[model samples]
Target: MTESLHIVCPHCHTTNRVRADQLASDPSCGSCKQALFTGHPAALDEAAFDKHISRSQIPVLVDFWAPWCGPCRQMAPAYEQACAQLEPRVRLVKVDTEAVPNLGARYAIRSIPTLALFKNGREVARQAGAMGAADIVRWVQAHSA
Candidate 1:
């Protein structure tokens, strides 16, 4: 039998089960029918963030940032590039601290451009400050492994 994995939809917040072996084949959400892994970070609000963090079987990498932070803006493209390289294996998300202050506080995020890696519904590792695409990818892979 093939092992399966749970993936939360970036578009609809619905959870779907996919075969582990078929992950690279481009899976779609059962409810929304949207592609599960888009090569860009999903912008998550409070409720969606909770669902994705708690329900997803795959690891989630979140960029905790604020709109007014220059470093956050500077790291945006690198994060996007990391998403392109990491997707289907990891879920990349963005939580805007300015809009979702509760999430930032809940995570005790003291600085902008923080990267938090979650696995099995809990944070396993975190990094502060901005980083390039290769560094982001390397950090996530190291932590997730």
Candidate 2:
């Protein structure tokens, strides 16, 4: 049997089961009917963040950042690029620390721009500070299970 993965819909926050091999086929959410991977990081609030991290079968890459931070603003574009490169395989997301302080606190995020990789309902790796698109992609690829 072909392996399958549970991917949370970035649009409606619904979970969908997808065959592993069909990842590249641009799957659509069964519930919301929206494209599963939009080639952009999903901006998740605390509730949505919890649902994705806990339920996603694929890897989850989170950018814990604040709007006022200069480095966080600067890394936005690169994070978008990284999202495009990594998505369908890894669900990339951003959580604004200022807007959702509890998530930041829950994850012990002390920095403005922190990248955390999670798999199987737990964090697997993390890096603090800003990075270029290539570096972000490489770091995630290297660390993700």
**Top candidate by TM-score:** 1
Q: Where does model 2 exceed 4 Å of error?
A: none
- Give the alpha carbon lDDT tens digit for every residue of 25-91 in model 1: 9999999999999899999999999999999999999999999999999999999999999998999
Residue-wise C-alpha lDDT for candidate 2, range 16-96, written one tens digit per residue:
999999999999999999999999999999889999999999999999999899999999999999999998899999999
Q: For candidate 1, what is the total of clashing residue pairs?
A: 0
Runs in model 1 lying further than 4 Å from the true structure: none
The stretch of ten residues in a row with the least summed lDDT in candidate 1 is 20-29
Candidate 1 lDDT for residue 55: 95
In the predicted model 1, the residue pairs found to clash are none
